[model samples]
Target: MGAFTQMIMGYVYPGKPLANATFEAYAMMCVDCGLTAISSFKLGLYMKIPPKAMFLSQVIGSFIASACEFATVWLLFSSVENICRPELLPRGSQWTCPYNQVIYNNMMTWGAVGPKRVFYPNGVYSNLFIFFLLGALLPIPVWFLARTLPEKKWIRLINVSTIFIAGASMPPVSAVNYLSWFAVAFFLKFVVYRKYKRWWAKYSYLLSVAIDTGVSLMAFLVTVTLQIHNVNGIDWWGLDVSDHCPLATCPTARGVHAEGCPAF
Candidate 1:
């Protein structure tokens, strides 16, 4: 998934660092403002609302959303790591096996243990999170840009461009996945604008929360299942592993040589 996301960001954004930066910015925006604000802003302009109100609402809402999102991610990192670590380990592999231990060691060595990796070594994941946090704060400028260009054509163009850029940089799979949300946003913009009076009234905040919660739960379940499968020596998503013996094969299987299959 991460690799897919990287591919999509690369294609959509184009410039090496800049493309990634843009994607991080956009994701942070979504995390902070809930898709509602973004959809509402686009809808409002499409419906010819006063630019001032639209800008104010988007800015204020985005700020609040970003704060909440930051807090939520922090809490999840703290709590989920504690609950998920044991489950990430191999069934019988000890802490000393380099290949089997790397996951747990990385988890702890990355600051899930004591000194936070965000402050120390400042590794890739930490840097990525920091970039995301910083990007969340960029909605202010986005709001300003939206206000400066209230004409529906420009607004739509900009939105589409960014989405395309982000999508292109992402892996084909990730781009396809993220495009689902873009499709939803596009539909909402059209429907909400057409029926302005029923927009917020028909879609309760609870509905949004429910959707987000369901997605998160699904992700968690999938992660746990994959971890368990990997640890149990099952094919991890059917990747090629002919070089290594299946766990079912003991160290002294039929004609297998001792050196070639040490862990047989």
Candidate 2:
């Protein structure tokens, strides 16, 4: 959340010595999000409202969101048989539990153990530390150019966050996964929003919500079926099946002395 806040603050309001500004922007990030209730009142833009009423509404809304998030997570965890187990949830499995696994891995990597070892000499990804400085320095030029020109819309696209975010995200969502997804999102948001303003205003967010909700419902149904199969000892088409391709993950590590397999 601090990183999210930092990036948003940098994007919205560029500052001198952007690195320091970024670090400072998230001072409020550590604050309990629910404790700060003023922003919630801004939802009613054109009306004068009672603070107590707004606070109540905000609390209720937060409660709903929190409940839904927890329920969804529990629903998946309960229904998915051997979730987060790669052996059960193969490459294209419907219940791979990627999100949960990512949280676990991230906790292991940077939670208890500090990032020093990972970014120090002889570390596997020590080379990535250079990008941290590079990323921090990037906004200076963009900010300078924007200040000079002041009218070029294209200047906004020269965001350092874009480059570094893409670099980091590419490994998880490889070319095959993200190329077409990004292209479609770009076209819809940038092109369609400009060309079909009315349609976009009416349907863009609506469509996104509908699609996401539909997918969630479908996944829930799939999860229920999986749980049922587990209890009944019935077999069906492997809903959690995939290519199982672990490219660059050597067979030697898996007890196979295959030729050209790099043992880590």
Candidate 3:
């Protein structure tokens, strides 16, 4: 029944199927919300909270979050320039908004056009289906061992979904983001946690949360201020760069392909 609804949505909007796309996203959101709630539920259990109160709190929290998040989406979409304009953003511009593009790409792939058209024989991405099938089948044996043995530590090493999601995320995300994330993650995972166990247990997760919050809040305030003052962007080395940088306009390069960008 839902499949038919999605098809009708695709037809009604021809090249644009955002409604069905949002519907499908809502479905996935519910699933992930449940997954997140399971961890919280376990914490509640450990804390000896009454089940009724815990459930009520979760419901209230989810409702409040949904409202605030939707409002945030409206504000950004209404206020930001070049949000959907990939071409307009010079490299390193904060407005590149890879996260929004990821959703737009997914909607076009899975909502407007169905998976068979996108993943079947001779499709542009037909080769990726093998990984999909592999991901589906890979966890069974690992799950079986974990369930049957219940105490084996080695059975938890297989997490194909996380790997796939991260692999997909990297291409759309800016290189600077990945570089910074890897630097911090490598330090924590390999150096800090491994070599300084006591310090890590005391400060690692809290430090990560603080950094993420601070960076996000700063970016928001900076963007709002720039917009208010009618500023395009700073022309410093950090903000102004070619889309492909380091090679798009190097002194050694030749021809008008660089669009007359002064060789740096």
- TM-score for every candidate vs. truth? 0.29, 0.60, 0.64
Point out where model 1 deviates above 4 Å.
1-41, 82-169, 172-264
Which is the winner by TM-score between candidate 1 and candidate 3? 3
Residues 9-56, model 1: lDDT tens digits? 544443344445445456655664566666787888878999899989
lDDT by residue for model 2 (129-184), tens: 67668878889999999889878979977877876666555333445557777887
- Tens digit of lDDT per residue, candidate 3, span 108-155? 865667555655543466676576568778778878888898778766
By TM-score rank, best first, the candidates go 3, 2, 1
Q: What value does the lDDT take at residue 115 in candidate 1?
A: 22
Model-by-model lDDT, in order? Answer: 0.51, 0.60, 0.68
Off by over 4 Å in 3: 1-20, 42-54, 77-83, 86-93, 122-124, 136-161, 227-264
The clash count of every prediction, one per candidate, is 17, 1, 0
RMSD of each: 15.2, 9.1, 7.5
Model 1 RMSD in Å is 15.2
| Model 2 misplaced regions, further than 4 Å | 1-54, 61-79, 90-92, 111-114, 121-124, 149-152, 166-177, 225-245, 250-260
Model 2 accuracy (lDDT, Cα): 0.60
